[model samples]
Target: MALFLLAFFRRYLLLVLSFLCQVYVLLIRGTPIVVQVMFIYFALPLLANIRIDGLTAAIFTLMINSGAYISEIVRGALQSVPKGLKEAGEAMGLPFYKILRHIIGPVAFRRMIPAMGNQCIISLKDSSLFIVIGVAELTRQGQEIIANNFRSVEIWGAVAVIYLILTGLIALTLKLIEHRMRIV
Candidate 1:
């Protein structure tokens, strides 16, 4: 089915995008995320005569930002996959794409799940930085609540708890996948 094919190639496409994101990371990692958000939200409007909404800008910035780190994780996992597996796939007369799909990708992906999970958690936390650009994510929402109710301690604490819950869920999901993919 078309859906299965799409799912199958998603990783490869993500891998390529992740590589590009890695390059972005190498360039911007030293800069603060606040600066990055400001550049997209403030500088772009002034320089390019463009205006993008907070949520869209935040998602774009975070995707590329997180992509950079995720890409490095992906590259390492790809490299860690055993070379013998590729040879075995080829020996079975599998084509390059087939070999990658059936062997290289699955093996590398399973090994990379933990790192990927780490990246996801990092990304979710980084979403808080979007508050600088006025996006209404959890952090921004908390800020608004505090601004209205003057309950900085309680609201911010609740926001932190929400992020912890989200990250914990991500960790559990990755653990399940890692268990399912264990080599035995």
Candidate 2:
């Protein structure tokens, strides 16, 4: 969410602030978050003397990875706002920031709902990848339970249902938001 706000700030308020953001997005999107997590958790200690635990590394790596994608979604949505409204806002003696806050932000955010909501679901699914780093996430727990009880059918079924519920909630919530934001 903060990254989404920063994306808007960079696009309209301060161009220079966006350079580093763009590089961060490029680097994160260029590589798999798994590899990024591995680098942070393992390579960083050997090369830069920065060592974080698996969970911390995984969380931060996922955050940066997701932030990069979310920023793009936000930027695209913000850019889709019409140029005329900005000019009008300027004619009304409004600063760019105020125009964005009162005008562009709401419209862009409404447009952002569908894409951003999909990203939320993607983030949830992607978190399962952290199991490779020994995060003991839902999938890992399912694996452990199956190994112990040989109930793969039931355990996996339950896990699948839980994930479905989560993604469903995200979709439903976003739909509600979109409905509420309708220009009444």
In every candidate, how many clashes are there?
2, 0
TM per candidate comes to 0.80, 0.93
Error of 1 at 12 (Å): 12
Alpha carbon RMSD to native, model 1 = 4.9
- Using TM-score, give the best candidate's number: 2
User: Candidate 2, residue 58: CA error in Å?
Assistant: 1.5
lDDT of 2 by residue, 125-184 (tens): 988889888998899999999999999999999999999999999999999999999898
Q: Tell me model 2's lDDT, rounded to 2 decimals.
A: 0.88
Candidate 1 ranges with C-alpha deviation above 4 Å: 1-25
Question: Which one wins on lDDT?
Answer: 2
User: What's the TM for model 1?
Assistant: 0.80
In model 2, the runs with Cα more than 4 Å from the true position are 13-16
Question: On residues 21-94, what C-alpha lDDT tens digit does candidate 1 reach at each position?
Answer: 44555776667777777788778888989888888788877765665566566667767888899899999999
Q: RMSD, model 2, all Cα superposed? A: 1.6
**Between which residue pairs do clashes occur in model 1?**
21-68, 22-68
